[model samples]
Target: MKKSILVVEDQSSQRKIMVEALQKAGYVIFQAGDVQQAIDLINQQKPDVLVADMHLPNGDGGDVIREARQLPGAPVAVVAVSIDLAILNQNLTATYQADAYLSKPFHPRELLKIVEELVGVSH
Candidate 1:
């Protein structure tokens, strides 16, 4: 089966772009605009990977990571995104147990590359 990915980003346009890129790469994509939406989707079915943005509307990436880690399919490969906050760097990988991360204003290819690495997807 094709691997599934959950993209938890608050920005509408950004989410659409990432989702499109991932779909082209042949991944089943799911997305959420806020913390509640993310949590709801995550509980229903765990995605093979989670790409979460740090600064969200209701909550941050930390909440998403922490919640995902507790799910049955735990230790879900996470790629946390932030807006050039050095502190977010330490938080994503360390505190939240994310496998990878990205800074905002980055190329879509970069995020896709990290997702590929995390899920072992080959072009």
Candidate 2:
């Protein structure tokens, strides 16, 4: 089965673009526009990987990453996405345990590669 991924981004256009790219790359994709929506999705189905934007409505992407780390089973591989990479912080991965970070204006291909690196296609 194709690995699943949850992409939490607030901007509609950017979220749609990234979702489309990941879908074309053969991933099972889930999308959330806000922190609550992301949390709801996670509660329903835990994806193999999480791609989260740093800024979000209701809560920040860090909330999702932190929660993902605490969930049952193997932890989710998290990729932090933000317009200001500085806000993501090097300590985020050490603290929250994210797998990767992607700056905004990043190439769609790079996002795919990062996700693939975290959760291989075979996974």
lDDT winner among the candidates?
Answer: 2
- Please give each candidate's TM-score: 0.92, 0.93
lDDT of 1: 0.85
How many clashes in each candidate? 0, 0
Question: lDDT by residue for model 1 over 1-123, one digit each (tens)?
Answer: 888889999889999999999999999999999999998888887888989998899888889888888887345888888885784646555776888878887888998899989878763
Instruction: Give per-residue CA lDDT, model 2, range 1-123, as digits (tens).
Output: 888999999999999989999999999999999999998888788888999998998889889888877779987889989887567666776755678888889889999899888887564
What ranges in model 1 sit over 4 Å off? none
Cα error, candidate 1, residue 14 (Å): 0.8
Task: For model 2, give the 10-residue run with minimal summed lDDT.
Answer: 88-97
How far in Å is the alpha carbon of 82 misplaced in model 2?
Answer: 0.6
